[model samples]
Target: MNNLDLQKLLDEMTLEEKIDQLLQLAPAFFEGANSAGQITGPLEGLDLAVENVRRTGSVLGVGGAEEAIHIQEAYLRHNRLNIPLLMMADVVHGYRTIFPVPLAMGSSWDVELVRQAAAIAAKEAAVAGIHVTFSPMADLTRDPRWGRVMESTGEDPWLNGQFARAFVRGYQGEGIANEPYKIAACIKHFAAYGAAEGGRDYNTVDMSEWMRREFYMPSYRAALEEGCEMVMTSFNTVDGIPATGNRRLMRELLRKEWGFDGVLISDWGAVKEMIAHGVAEDEKECALKAIEAGVDIEMMSSCYPHHLQELIASGAVDVQLVNEAVMRILQLKHKLGLFENPHRYADSVAEREILLNEQHLAAAHEAALKSSVLLKNERNVLPLAKDAKVALIGPFATSDDLLGPWSCMGKREEAVTLAAGMLGVADPNTVTAIGCGVEHIPDEELAAMVEAANSAEVVVLALGEDSEMSGEAGCRANIQLPDRQLELVKRVRALGKPLVAVLFNGRPLDLHGVLDEADAVLEAWYPGTRGGAAIAELLYGEANPSGRLTMSFPHSVGQVSVYYNAFNTGRPKDDPNAQVRYVSQYLDIPNEPMLPFGYGLSYSSFRYGEAALSSPLIRAEEKLLLTVTVTNVGERAGSETVQLYVRDIAGETVRPMRELKAFRKIMLEAGETKEIEFEINEPMLRYHHADLSYKSDPGKFEAMVGPNSKEVQALSFELV
Candidate 1:
């Protein structure tokens, strides 16, 4: 619909209808809604009649094309204005052919692969009649205690921003002007929801404006820049005010300043829950504040319908706020071409054809292969010989729960198991197995399992958090492997056999307990649908491991929030000539992360040549060319991600020790040397200053080019 038609429809809406349009609900609100995606029963109170639901502009947490059609037909049947209900869902990773969780995808360090995965998710979700997906969660987090880290693409703002843009472009493929399989992307939890105090879910966040802009807001900016059509308000407070009701954040900064006119949504029940947050006295005030703050849609609650009309009558609120919100909602609907055809995406034939199609499944398989990071490989025990007898032991050995949390559309039964994958590559008879469980087993049972591993030439010990133990509401104080799993590692170590530990988890786990025992460790974070096949291939040298860590794996839970790019403290962790007492060192453990960000190993070794610079000095306007030669030293073809890092030697404000500025992923054959060059420009050096201005500080700067953050060669340059 055009602007004229949208305005006419908005003008025609009654106060009650307008308020209802702002409300989003599940299928239970509709009379004949299916149970496929229903999170809860119909919410009680104000207006949930079938007619009210018909006018309710949007529905979420409902599954399938036929069900969406059922609900949309019901809504359109009773409508005088013929407005269709907008369908939305959290297609977080995949709709059917689930790829690895976003965290694992981030590990791949391949933006194009991430985009392709999102495109696949969009295609599958679009066929199911979903108009919007709340995905590419751009929350910058550090603490592993945040269970939702599985949803985020890890801790770096720069990396997250890159992934955020890729996801937006993939989901909104050439905009709404395109066909099915492309939908609007929603960059969620608007500001610093990940930096919740102590990393607890839904906890408060107290961030300084400088810290907020410097570290947390970049990914959101990247999303909006990529044309993300919606923004979801976070549950946490920014400064003292909850982001859902903070005008300065939602309106002044997001809408006016950043120029985002897209629809703004509240995380499920975030609006009314603001009362519990002590920011509002009641639901009325919560609704008033959220609407005034420019939240166009109240998801999963009755706040607006419960109080908007009364507030309008009592002169506590203006109806214009409601109209503007509704207009934004209508714009989304129009852009989606919903006005032209509400049932466009609801096609059962297309849904049958697209879900888990061969190409999508293959992409998922490749993604899983690249996402498995080789955390530790001692004595070169990895890249198992094709003829080697394999014993795959673990509770996950045959289980298909590889589909991690947030995989709503993916059926676990369809997931390929490790046992199945091993059988697919080689003879099933050559692969022995035992019950490898995350939880504890009886001593006798454990002994029997160990006996099975003893017969194989090499053992593949599958372990890590249960699927339910590492997602939303799945926070763990102890991120180490479970007690039984830890004990199993020790037992396997006593056998003095070559072993590989395949970890299926969401967050960066503290691997200290089991690290020393395992000969090789692969962080295969909840590697979705094709997880089994990918791991099997990596083991047999079919695919070389190339994925890197996006989030730093802490040496211990005590160091929960660890990352490569950290501010230089007043004192360093260890001064070679000084006593340890004065420095910011941890007495018990080293201050360094166990596995630093951008750290990964491939089967083939890579050697980085000292970086060569075009010039040591350069004007602000002119660019400096930084070049480095990366050679594959090992006797195999492989992929390497060459990272570019920078440090502000001196600046107007404090700076991180090293910041990732750019990276390039390239493939090389044995003994092949490739030259990689990156343009160093003024924009790359800019940051949010003490006064909130974004600009580059003219000063001496250092750049490093290498395989990862920790291992690099540096060169100095001047930006004058």
Candidate 2:
């Protein structure tokens, strides 16, 4: 419909009709739509009439083309104007052909690959009649205790911002405004939801504005700048105001300063959560605050439909607010071509033909392979010989749970297991396998594992959290390997057998025990469907592992929030001349992460030459050129992630010891060398100052090039 047509419809809509456009619910409230989305609670609490639900503009968490057609048909039958229901779901990783989780995607350091994975997801979901996906979460996570870290791109704001844009491009595909086989992208949990105190999900988030702008806000803005069509407000409060009701954050900043005119949405039940937050007295007040604060749609809640009309009639809010929100909602619907054909996405033929095809599965396998980070390879223990007798033992050894959590539409039975992958790649006579539960390793299970190891030349212990243990609401106070698993690792280490620990976890794990006991460690994060095949390929030398760590592995649970980029303290532990007694070093352990960010091992070794700079001073208009020659000194061909980090020697406020400004993942042949160049511009050097103003202070800066954050060769330059 044209703008005039949409406006006329808005003018004709009754107060109930207008509120219906702002209401979003699961399938239970609407007839014929199945339970594809989670139900927050019963619909009885909503007190919404059946007619109101029938007229609701959108449906959440409902999947399948047939189901979608049924929903749209049911709604149109009851509606006076024949409006179609917009279908949205939490298609975070994949709809049917699952890919690696977002954190795993970050480890690949390949934006194009990540984009392709998202595009594949969109294609699969679109055929199933999905129109919008709450995806590419874009939250910069520092703590692994939060289970939702699986949905994020990981620690660094710069990298998260890059992945955010990639997800947006992949999902919205060169402007989804009119594109088919695509869906609108929603960059979610706006404004620092990942910084929840103590790493608890939905917990209080208290942070300085300087820290928020400098570290947490970049990715959200980046996704928005990439034309992300929707924004989902975070659950926690920001600056003493819930983001859903904060006029300063949503209106003054997001809308006025950032110019985000796209549809803004509240996370599931976040609107009524204001009462739990003690910010709103009742539902009426909550409706008033959210609309005024710029929320266009309320998800899984009755705040808008139940109380909006009363609030409007009471003059607590202007009717123009509701009109603007309805217009935005209608505009998005029109953009999706909903008015043109309510059943545009309901294509059962395409659904049966396009989903989980061989091509899509191959791409998923490729993504899973690249996303697996080889965290440790001691004494060249990895790349196991295909002829050597290998023992695979763990709960995941034969289980198809490799699809991981939030794999909304992937079928578990279709997933390949380690045993199947081994049989496919290795000599059947050389592979022995047994299923030992991840936790509660009984005497019988241990004896069985010992027998399997005794008959094999080497052991590959597949262990990590289950799919149920590390996604939404999967937070853990102790981010370590399960006690039974650690004990089993110790016992296996005592057996004097060569060991390789293949981990399948969602978040960064405290691998202290596994690292000490195992000869090799591979973090195959909830790798989707082809995960088993990818792991087999890497283990058999068919694929070289190059994935890097996007999140730091903590030395201990006490180091929960440790990340690579941190403010330099006055009593810095890195000061070589400082005495140990007065330095900022831990007494029991070193002031370092167990596995530092940007760290990953490969079958090949990489050597970096001294950094070369074009000039010592950088002008405002010109970018400084820095080059480093990287060589694959190992015998095998492999890929390496050459990272470039910078440190601001001086600023108005203290600066992080080192910040990741740029990186390039390069593929090289044996003994091949390549000169990688990076351009350092003004924006790269700027940070939020004491007053929250972004600028680069005139001072000497250190540019470092290396394989990871901990070790690097430094070169000094001045930003003048």
Give TM per candidate. 0.98, 0.98
| Model 1: lDDT to the true structure | 0.87
TM-score of 2: 0.98
Model 1 lowest lDDT segment of ten: 38-47
Flag regions of model 2 displaced more than 4 Å. 40-44, 576-579
Please give the distance, in angstroms, between residue 66's alpha carbon in candidate 2 and its true position after superposition.
0.2
Residue 562 displacement in candidate 2 (angstroms):
0.3
lDDT by residue (1-720, candidate 1, tens digit) is 689988988888888889889988877777557864635233555455666677787888667888888888878888778888888888988998999999999999999999999999998888889999988799997999889999999888999999999999889987965755689999988999999988788889997999999999999999999999999999999879999999999999999999999999998888888888999998899999998999999988788988899999999999999999999999999899888998767788899999999999999999999999998889899988767888888767777889899996899988988788877887777888676567766788678768878888888898888888877778888888888778777887788889988888999988976677899998889999999999888977888999999999999989878888898787886557666698887889888989999999889999988789999987878999999999999999999999999999987889999999999999999999999999989999999888999999878999998888999899999988
